[model samples]
Target: MTSVSRYMSYRGYQFPMLKYWSPSLGVTMLGVVGAILFLAMTLGPKPYYWPTDASYGSSPPIATRAGWMALALLPFVLGLSVKANMISVLTSIPHEKLQIFHHWTSYAMFLLALIHTFPFIIYHIDKGDMVKQWKTSLVYWTGIGAIIPQAYLTIMSLPFIRNRFYEFFKATHMIAAVVFIVFFFLHCDFRLSSWDYFIASGIIYFLCLSFSQVRTYLMHGIHTATLELLPSGLARVSVPTVIKWTPGQHVFVRFLTPDLHLLTAHPFTISSVYRDPDQAGKAPELAFYIKPRRGVTARLAALAAKQTGITKKILIEGPYGGVSTHHMSQFDTILVIAGGSGGGFSLAMVDEALRVSGLHTGEDESGQESRRRLQVVFSTRDTPMADWYIDEIESRLSQSTTLPGSDNGFETSVSVHITSKPDLTRSTSTLDSEKGTAGKLPPTDITTTGSFSLNIYRNARPDIPGLVARTVAMAHANPMPNGKKQRIGVLVCGPASMLHDTRNAAALAQKRTFGGEIEELYLHSESFA
Candidate 1:
């Protein structure tokens, strides 16, 4: 199928939205420019590229005000979106376009703000004599602070520079955002617009952001958030969520504590839909069955040691863009690729599938007659992490043996691919001791009737070829159930690099001309990195 059909069939969104939102930014370009035009039209002559309002000193330069409006627009647009979770607002745009908008608008904000500062700068440069008094002026200082963020923001906006120094860029990018917000309050002297759209926008941003903070604060009073290690190595964290998850999505995380400065919230694909709706004052509890990492996962480990209730506040905001397959009809073959923490999301889907597997399989199977296979490829860098949940896995596997209404899931197929096992400088137990355990899955593997197995290795680089090997081994295992187009769909989540390669692999595999038959493989990915 063509890209449009695939997207329309899977995502249930207008085809134009994806193509325009594609890295080349075909559509967002027009939208953003149009927004700029509207602002310009409301303010002056140059409605597209130039800022018409240059007046300063009086109240706020019209240009300055408009710049604030634009800066504020991003979060405002986000606040209203169903996906607005403070945790991963960065997930709003596609990678390439995200980079473009993140850079350009930021630089534009900086330039506009800087241009708006011109009168002040001219006035001050005229009087280096009045430097001391000028520097103390509220407007002057606020503009200066804004300038500080602008400089860093501008530097990071450069593609090559940002690529070269991504860590510093990310950190500074976040810092710049906070700084921008601070300078905004100073710019407005905190009263906010006081009424109308400006006030409404400001309030919305405040409530959206502050809601997360206040909810967490009330839940976990002092010691930072707690991480409860569930029995199956699935860490149960009661994050402050305002509502139910839309399913098949993930978010970025950051620690609330001061000491763990680098203890950012790692992105974990959300596992399940929020079951309760009427629960009051209770922020949604997000779940993650994390595959332990050494240095990076230390904070989660620390939380696993919690004795009673939540220690510190945990921030949660997100229902980021999720799987395209959320809307797709249940297909014949569903190949899910979960590497490391990626499994959190896929396993959640599998959990849902396992519960319904019997309804579609064996003697009494019904709706799933059209669906033939349930294939999963799990690429992990740790082996024992698998051991951590093997009990529950085995239980599920056994459950497959005895269908609720029948016997032996001779109908479906299940496969797990363990791509690698890296040396963990730290262990899950050690981490568990520090942070209290959350919860666990049962002790059983998931097995259907055909080709159930686990493949393991210790490779330094888990590349496309390796992934292709495992996936192909699973796909061609039984000749795609007698001549049906192989029709495989993949959902991959892991390191961004690995996900990209997996996508490439899936594409490569689909391009081949088979013997008297044709097959198509579809790939999807979620990146926490």
Candidate 2:
């Protein structure tokens, strides 16, 4: 199918506002040029290129222009690749979006690198000294070395090859990065106009690396990870560290063991909020619900299944990437859709919303109206995984009584959908009352508390578009407590298909004005891969 048709089909309706905010090829190209101009302005235009003699148009001014442009863009490329990018931090743009800019900027730099190289060679050839320069100039050789590795790295970065051979790709990518920097510096040889860019890039990269190393050492030096293997290829890795993290954030973990090496650090969502009991000045604890995909995860799962008692050292990198603060408290209705192990992130979002709701009491003409309604829809192939999450939901709800007037708290609902074959004895065949369709369904309302409920269904997957539509309608039905318009936030962390469906559904919902009340829908997607 065509990409537009697939997008429209998933969207269910067109939403110009959401569509316009997406990244564009044209915009990226413009940004590339803008960035170059911004840097060039800093370097003050002079006679950037001057010929040694009158013939051949004074040595092709491109030699100097191209060299300076390449230098100016180097810092941007380096900074964007780092997790704690200064530009991203300052601009409040998510690192993921910065990564898109990073990719395009790299392409621009590659073009500049070509421009920087061939023009110098051609200018020298026009002077009839190309072979002599090549034979004697260390700068020439170093530039050649830098360009060759960079070109090789760029070619190997093709999606098919990178995904298929990730380990080799990672190793070579790092090596090539180091090689590029070393030769790039030597080739420039402290040229005054461009030295600042190289120095800035080096400083930024050094700080990022140093901070990561120091943070890992301080956080995990005294920590321990206890792994419990769960049903359906899920393993729970629990680490006692005292660092607090926002909901939906993730960390890179390196497990040091005979089976697992330091080279295998992988990112995983912190499935739960940090719990700090304030006991003996210890740090907060965190847990990860890991699915063994391949490589490091598979090896770790196997080791955990064996139940060895030896203490294993670990390194924890960060609590990186989270939902923006602007999107956190404004939403009146929050829908979290997760598939399989992606529940790790969704459940934490649910917990955060509930916690926030308890802290803030929304008051209006009608006193004390609960402003947040949180819905969790988790789909998995195995009943056991669903059962585990069901238990977690009940446990969290029971703990909510600690809040003042705790009996009446936020409105939270959970739905666990088992899409594969089901246990016939436990699940009764019923029709979906909301959809008015006949299907093999479980009880619509399996369990309920004062304002919390858990629904379980069998032999079906969630209709992403239908659920989003119904929820938006319900949210719009209630007027906002203050004069503000009602807002809905849809967050999905799952397989690509689930993320796509949830995103498109959100895009469609955001377009509706809801009688000029501006019922807004925003979608946040988290993918561990």
Candidate 3:
């Protein structure tokens, strides 16, 4: 296999385990090219994808321009595919292929875009007519905006940042991308390429995103929700979606307007469910904690703020992420590490863990029978979001007493690390005691023998050395309740920093136990930022 092939097959995105039929990137590209080619052949000449001098506009100049332009577009398209294809699905294409294309092609695209624009600019400059310049003006600036961010996103998509300083890159990429795509569409005027195809591309991506949303909404619901605030700026809204979702599974949501019919959806794992305290049914109602930020969410917030009720519908799709939750019941104890609204996710699993076999104690409290230890280390800088979270925590705490399995009950500990704002200095100092939790819960010295974790850079993301050491410590200190060696699964969702650290920690832990082979493994990673 070629180096490019290797990169595509393995080095790109972290493929989440799922059972959906997703097409391979190679297949998708081939199909797209086929569509483009057929159109070009049918149309004959101008704007044709492939070339021949006399018949089609495949002159060396157009060919070079098109080829380079395609390359420049590679990063944006590839990067988008990578983001959209976050779940490790059953695709003819493995997750890595497009990433490779996205990475390498991005450079080619950047240079090609420059080629396409500069020559046109230079030729136009000689005429120097203000009216003529204004005519071609709109898309140039917009396309440039799109290109600049696409270029930066491509640079950071490298494994170094993609896997290492992922938090910053992820946030940067998402923010840049939303802005870029908006500009991208406007910049073109849909004149050069087949307008239908360009529109089709928008539809293609939107379809994937919309399908996920509609599915999720139908399954989850968009009405009657009580928003509770947790301690860490985490807001948990429990709505009754008639849909039943599996544990360790997730879905996409879009709560906009007629735009929801066109725009992409935001992804989130269901944090709490009411269907199966035992998780016995195929369907269930759920609760989700949302960390309000820019992008899709900010708009959702604006809509909510203006709303008189829960009429804003969110499109939801997928019973995606076939993450194994069996160990949840089998482990001696389950340790969950969550940040901000991520704590809501813990509540979902934690409620179930209390009832699962090994994790539960023999004694039945109030005759319901339950005993499971779930520790949530929640940290937040005092903000309006934090206020929202505190309200949720109080409500959940009040409701926890009634959750079937929680009769004997699990203790819900809220760790509020507040300072001025996003300052890592004084805040990190206060949070220092939370050192040895799964992804920084609390030091084992302050906690018990059942579980422990390591902190994920409360300041700047932990460097590689710090991460390696943290992974080592967590590996060595893995709590194996009842003194038995067992498989410990990890499901992390929050900032990209925690995901990276958790992934590395999980990997090393597996290696520490079995000779470098992942055993009984299930990892589900999602980034809210």
Candidate 4:
């Protein structure tokens, strides 16, 4: 076998288990949390500090200090919970990664609450005034109210419980959080100095959420979205909005017109072109490919399907995510791997690579012309999805070929794999000879009908590692104008297993020097869960 073929079949290197946990984010969080804890324990003014050896003597001041620390953590926990978070805006870190710090800080706050609770109780009991303290002080009762929910919140946040009952978890978590905040402030008796952080956290959350809501209203003005239910149990909802978003970013959508659960918004990746305007001076239209799963999506689909020309007043919360943009253009070649609905994210990136390459000109930081090779691999469970997305894939590829400064735009390839058997019982006897599928509507004839080609694989899935290796090899072998080291960016948005495979392949490639001695590989994943 040829060297290219040999390299493609080789299973590459795997990193140690700890690397999979995203060590950089972990390390950063550890340093920050440790510093905060150390300062809280050591540097704060100890107003109740005493040289007394008695346990009851130190309880009041230590508990009060811990209470302060717990309150201080509230802003960060709330900040990280927001989609349009200030920390992410400042740091340029994905909000998803920031969630790790959120979880840890919440635990820290819970620990502090525990620490804050026992000492005061010990002091009250030691003085034989426990019952009197509870009866006389609103602080004692309000503190109990705050601590109980905080403990409950932590219990309900366990991964297995959360994933199983997400809606319940979300509702209870929100309610409990609000209760905790209120009681926490009251527990401090609304002392502006002591309760200021909780108030700040509430303000931050309100501003972020309200800003997102107001922006959407300003752009779309209580927009009506047209929902068309497709045969594949997927519904396409298209809405015209004034805002433009980067490819692969998602918007949180709520169907205000729907009778069922109109308040709960769900995030869906924009499946259509990022900034396409159908006419001059018209609002850019956005589209979402939504599967009819349980909850709001399912209800929305059923409601839309029953009504002809269904239009709903919708709320769009954001054009969030797509942090991959920070480094996508730095690479010479791009490989996008996606599965099922996750194709929404991958396809957007594919479109972005094409759009930027066609539109970009002049020199880069390295004084090299804009040039890139894009390879798209989409795997789906059945043919209907494949058919729908494949048409979109072809249209985008064809559009790229004709765009201005697109001489190199045709340097793209699309491979679609369908894992399930086609419903051949519905197939017509006279199969379209041009397209391989025997069906009522044959797949697109890429050679005859499109400027670019699409390879459709049925009853099989592409070997993720092998395909990645071959693509990396091809990119490495191709010569760049400036002869700088080739960089390959592998962007995956799919099931966890698919992401794991793609990440593994990218990691393997990074270890080896490809055809060139200094070939580099970077992997970015968009995870819905």
**Model 4 RMSD, rounded to 1 decimal:** 6.5
Give the Cα error of residue 262 in candidate 1, in Å: 14
Q: Sort all candidates by TM-score, best to worst.
A: 4, 2, 1, 3
For model 3, residues 1-529, the per-residue Cα lDDT tens digits are 2323322221122344631222333444655675466335333445423332354331235444553345334334633464335233445333333454455455455555554555445444544653576565675577677778777776777665565655456446768867766666676565555355456556656765665455555545554444454444344555556666655566655544663333555567777644553555554566676776655444445545554244554555554552345666554334455555665665566555544443455544344433333434444444444344434443444444454453434433443332233432322222221223231222221322212221222222223324333433443454333433334444555654455455555444444444432123334455554
TM-score of 2: 0.79
lDDT of every model, 2 decimals: 0.51, 0.71, 0.47, 0.70
TM-score of each: 0.57, 0.79, 0.50, 0.80
Model 1's alpha-carbon lDDT is 0.51
Q: Tell me the tens digit of each residue's lDDT in model 2 across 1-529.
A: 2233323323522335543223333344566687777456534565444656545453346666776777888888888887766776687665765776776677667777887778777677867989998899898898998888778776676555666777667656878888988888888888776788887888998887777778888644646788877754688888877677888888878877656756656678888775546744766668888888767778768877888433467888877887854576778888999998998888788777766665566564567465567788999887767767766765676577545555424567788888888665665333222224332344343544355666777778999889998888777677666655667788889976676667677656645643454456666778665
| Weakest ten-residue segment in model 3 by summed lDDT | 448-457
Runs of candidate 4 exceeding 4 Å displacement? 1-65, 121-129, 190-193, 276-281, 323-330, 360-371, 402-408, 421-453, 512-520
Candidate numbers, best lDDT first, in rank order: 2, 4, 1, 3
Please write out the lDDT profile of model 4 over residues 1-529, one tens digit for every residue: 2223323322233245633323232344565877686456934766544444655443577777777788888888888888888887887766765676787788788988887888788767867889988899888889999989898888788665776777677657888988887888788886658767767987998887777767777764577798888866677788987767877778888768546556567788887555656644677778887777767778778877998558888878788776455476667788888998887777678767866675666455677664567788899997778877776776666655555544644356777888877665555333222224333234332322244446667678889989988877676677576777677777888866677677667656755554344466666677666
Residue 171, candidate 4: Cα error in Å is 3.6
